[model samples]
Target: MYRANEPIDGGQNQNAATVPGVVARPRAIRDHLTPILDDLNPGIVAPEIQAAHFELKPVMFNMLNSIGQFGGSPHEDARQHIHAFLEVCDSFRQQGAHEDVLKLKLFPYSLRD
Candidate 1:
């Protein structure tokens, strides 16, 4: 009943669904990741990309919750919002906005560890 862009925890009708958010939870994502991963752009494959992508889900959820409540920075609560924003940018690539994709691809790294 929810579109991918719509906030899952937004204050419409909380009781209507036990599950919430852009992507579903661990169980559902785990079960479906293989096929979905197969279909996705291959560059997404980092060592812990899936976990990095979804494990911080509480960040996105909390962002939605906070934004719906009042004026705020959804990002202030969690750095995961950075990744969430990245996901949104990537999604927009299908519509031909490639500079962000290129920038994401070309991010510089520090040699120091």
Candidate 2:
């Protein structure tokens, strides 16, 4: 058990030594992390990438509905229905449709009530 102010080894505080040409400064956590954080998360995306992303359009609901619907009927072959749906999705993808937008927006329209 050692006292807080008492020197630990040979009457010297081993942790209190200062290095040559080095100055200790008080700083916030944000200050130390700002450079790393900035590198990891640049706030703004490049304009060309943004433009390319914005240009991708999802297939319209009406178009997807017109293509086909799967009602989960016992007579319906699930594999065939899934294959057909994926085929259509693939065609749309080839035409620059965003995959997420197509799946989220158009998939529901291909479901029969």
How do the residues 12-100 of candidate 2 rate in per-residue lDDT, one tens digit apiece? 54675444555444468888786655448665333222224543244454456656788888988878877776767666652344465
Taken over the whole model, the C-alpha lDDT of each candidate is: 0.39, 0.58
What does candidate 2 score on TM?
0.39
Which candidate ranks first by lDDT, i.e. highest? 2
| Candidate 1 C-alpha error for residue 56, in Å | 27
Shift in Å, residue 51, candidate 1:
34
Residues 13-105, candidate 1, lDDT per residue (tens digit)?
555345344553225566755564556776653332222222223444444444332223554533454454445334332233333443343
Whole-structure CA lDDT of model 1? 0.39
Ten residues in sequence with the least summed lDDT for candidate 1 = 104-113
Kindly report which residue pairs in candidate 1 clash with one another: none
Question: What's each prediction's TM-score?
Answer: 0.20, 0.39
Which whole-number lDDT from 0 to 100 does residue 77 have in model 1?
36
Give me candidate 1's TM-score against the actual structure. Answer: 0.20
